[model samples]
Target: MNQEFKKYQAQTSPHPLGLEISHAKGSYIYDIENNAHLDFVAGVSATPLGHNHPKVIEAIKTQLNKYMHVMVYGEYVQKPAVELAKLLAENLPEPLEQTYLTNSGTEAIEGALKLAKRATGRSEIISAKNAYHGNTMGSMSVMGYEERKQAFRPLLPNVKFITFNNFEDLTNITTKTAAVILETIQGGAGFIFPQKNYLEAVRKRCNEVDALLILDEIQPGFGRTGKLFGFQHYNCIPDILVTGKALGGGMPIGAFTASKALMVLLQENPKLGHITTFGGHPVIAASALATLKEITETNLIYKTLEKEKLFRKLLVHPLIQEIRGKGLMLALIMENADITNQLILRCKDQCLILFWLLFEPKAVRITPPLTITVQEIEQGCQLILSVLNQIKS
Candidate 1:
């Protein structure tokens, strides 16, 4: 192990696919040994436009020459952040006109939860079983998996879990419920989608109970699902929508959107319900703005479905049981977690990087960049199938 990696870098797992990276461009990353590896993971689905996209990089340079962090919270009125918010307002659904930027997806979730409670004056929060919002304490409180969070017990109180695609459990979102937080696509849970009309029904139930609905679009936002936001695919709008991941192109950023009427609740009752030191740093916002521009202004958003079709068409193997999810946000279900593990490791060795979901061990994630070429898809799939043929059950 490298000295810095051994001493300073904390490992998320005892065994990591520790490949030292040199630089990346397009859909390829070069290691220190100059071995060019074809990227299929796209930095855990955060580089939807692929690595070092010229437009995104240019935006960062422009912003760097102008400004960086000006002040804390929403005090400075930075143009990149403000214009980015306005652009989101223009593209988003009705009443989702205002946005509060954050440093990461989990912070956006935290802000949404706080806003929901402040707006509804309710104490209970309802989330889905097998769902992942983030690793923060407030997010961990709602995580369905207990093994990873048991040691960090006594998180947020009054947090409840309901089945994701089951309308019957919607009764859990009662009048006392402050909010119902959910992933538009259950990312960590094998990219599991809500059954047809399930989201609409959930929206109706939330309205019936006067509980705010906070949809976590961290994974599937910014044209990952061939739509600006995954919630758009469901035809149901959330009271508060949290977005991140690819929102900053390759930069770390997050933002939650809501109606101005509802968002104002954060101002008066407590005056600054959520505050962060680097909430809307200008450079990050600039990259995000450029990413949004590329997705919306070009054909990148529409290309996702075509890329997804190519993936589905090529990823054929007897070991693969099912492919779940829409657009490019996808997963391949194997017979067991062991098989999934073997496949991921073998693919990495073969230069076709693959990863797994936090909650879905039997599934391997395949969320590539929207900019991934069709040839690249076929190439990666060929390598994947070859590995599957060579691997034993």
Candidate 2:
């Protein structure tokens, strides 16, 4: 099976850990050998409510019985898709009344970029340095890191990058800019939060230049940051809010939202400027509806602070240089990448799952499901401390 995976899997596989997962529930994933691994990474923060939550499973099954695929997106007004769109419109801030659903975050980013250019009739986009939006050409064009994107040379031109959280860089957003894209909280850059007044400053600058502010809430949305989205913590609203990952509760789904006025641009001036056949897959929409209901209807949204406090209190160690981020979206920065890798490997060897961030080599990720319990937190933390001590010597 491993050989087959390497042979026919398109050859993009990372250094596979080869764990062979069999099943998962709550905060634990079990291997085929029946060994349980306590999950701390939560599939890189994609499983917000945890693996196989009963409600989400029921929602998907219930929708499966009724229908699966009916027609091309935005044509028949499918039940699950319509209901999910309505729920999103009702929950978001004012003027964020229209949602265009897609298959993944990268597609949503592509659609949003097209919408911005169509709405403003401009060609330039500004993204933060070290930013990660997605992998599609349109999305990759704005990615901050050029090293990873170098092989795909000559990306969409007119895409510029600025230092994240730097007030002096606001001048770069001139009238030529159609949109300024940023992550509400930098995910691949090790869960970095916006400095004081940084987002507000960005908002103000965008307004001055008449450029739309696009917040990529893909990783930090869905109650991860103790609010409905990470931008809520910064007290600023984005013109275009892009989301994915946890939105579908383990199923694949992505969506971009804007005001009815802004979204209407995609419907005209070259009618159907952006289109996708599977944008609103019924089963995915149904699963997303269930996930949104769980996040919005329960106190699980506000309890993240207490959960984060518990983690911080118990995670003390001499080797831990700092703990960064808010709510359950956290990173523990160690002394160096070598130690970080050893600790992560040792933790998994001990049957406790931990992970590393993309850009921050010295950082370890701790973004579990919101349904994780206090007992589970203590257990995971204790295991982490033990691994840290072993690595320290």
Candidate 3:
């Protein structure tokens, strides 16, 4: 199977943590040989309720008995999709009442960019440097890292980059800007949180220019950051709020929300301006709705902070430089990339799933499932510390 995977499947990274999984539940993944691996990365922060969560699975099962994909998105009034959108609006801030669902995070990012451009009638998009929105062309164009994007050059024109959390860089967002897209808590760039008032200042500047603020909550949404959305932490609501990852509860989904007045423009001027065949698939929406209800209704969202405290309290070591980020969205900055790599690979061999940040080589990702218990936190932290000690010895 490993040989077949390497030969048949197209490779993204040269070295992939190819774990042949048999099943998963709660916070652990079982291999084909029945080795129980404690999952710390939570499928890159997608499985908030953990693997094959009963509620999410039951929702999918129930939806399957009724319908799957009746019609392409927006054509048919699917109950799951409509209800999910409505529930999202009920939870989100005002003016972000309407939602456009998509298949994945990247697709949602693309749609949000289009919406911003359509509403503002401007093409210039200001994005933060070292930011990772998504890999799609529209999202990639705004990616601040040059090396990753150099190969995909001649991307969406009029896209510019600015350093995140740098107040001076806020000036680059001018009246000509259509939207300033940013990751509320910049993932893949060491899980960097916005400095004090940085997001607020950006909101002020965008308001001044009448430019839209599109916050990408792909990694930090769905109660991962101790709030329903990461933007809520800073008290600055985005004009267009993009969300995904944990929103699906292990299912694949994405959505962009804005004012009805602003979103209705797509329906009139272009008439199906942004159309997707399987954007709001009924089964996926059902799973998402269940996931959202479980998070908002239960204490899981608030428990994230408590879990985060336990992780911080237990993960202290000399080799660890610093911890960056908030809530479950965290990165441990090792002294160097070598140490980070060693810790991740060694921990994996020890049946603990650890991962690295996309752009930050010296950082290790620690985004576990929000449903993870205190015992799981202690277990994972102990494994991490053991690996660190071995490396130090």
Candidate 4:
């Protein structure tokens, strides 16, 4: 199966963690040999309720029995999709009421960028340095890291980048700018959090320049952060909010939300300005609605902080420099890139699943499922410390 995966499946990386899976339940994934590996990555924060969650699975199954894709998005009034969008509007702030669902976070980012340009009639899009929105052409064009995007040159023009948390760079956002997009918490940049009213300052600047603020909450949304959304923690709300990853429970989905007036621009002047064939698939919407309801109704969102405290309390070592981020969205910063790589590989060998960040080589990702228990947290941290101790010795 591993050989087939390598040969048949096109891979993003040369060395993939080819773990042949038999099944997964709760916080552990079982290999073909029935080896139970404790999952710390949670499919890179896509599974917030843990593996094969009953509610998500039941929602998917029920929707599958009823129907699947019947028409393109915005054409039919599917119950699951309608309810999901309405519930999102209820939870989000004012003016962020209407939503346009998409296939993934990258697609949502593309839509948001287009909306900003259409609304303001400007083409300049501003982004933060070392920030990662997604990998699609539009999102990649806004990506700050030049090394990864050099090969894919001649991307969307009129995109600029500013240093995140750097107050002085706010001058770059002028009247010519259509939008300034940023991750509420920069994910690929080692889970960096905004410092000292940085987000608020950006909001004020965008307001002053009549530019829209688009916040990409793809990695930090959906109860992974202690709050329902990371922007809630900071006092700044975005003009366009982009979300995905955990939104679909374990399924694939993404969405961009804005004011009714703003989103309506996609309909009339262009007549289906942004259309998707299967953006809001019924099965995926059902799974997402279930996930959102469970997160909001239960204490899972609150427990994320408690679990984070447990992880911090247990994972103290000399080789570990610091842990950055809030709630379940965390990154373990090792002393060097080699140590970070060694720790992740060693943990995997010890039957624990650990992963790495995209741009930060010294950072090991620790975004596990929000449903993970205290015992699971302790178990994962113990394995991490044990590996660190071995590396130290």
All candidates: TM-score:
0.98, 0.98, 0.99, 0.99
Candidate 1 lDDT, tens digit per residue, 98-200? 9999999999999999898888888899998888999999999989888878999989999999998897898788988999999988999889887879999
Candidates 2 and 4 compared: the better one by TM-score is 4
Error of 3 at 337 (Å): 0.3
lDDT of 3 by residue, 167-283 (tens): 998889999999999999889788888888899999999999999999999999999989989888896999999998898888899999999998998897889999999998999
What clash count goes with each model?
A: 0, 0, 0, 0
Badly placed stretches (over 4 Å) of model 1 are none
lDDT of 2: 0.90
Cα lDDT computed for each candidate against the true fold: 0.90, 0.90, 0.93, 0.94
Clashes of 1: 0
Winner by lDDT: 4
lDDT of 3 at 112: 95
Candidate 4 backbone collisions, by pair: none
Assess candidate 1 and give its TM-score to the true structure.
0.98
Arranged by lDDT, best first: 4, 3, 2, 1
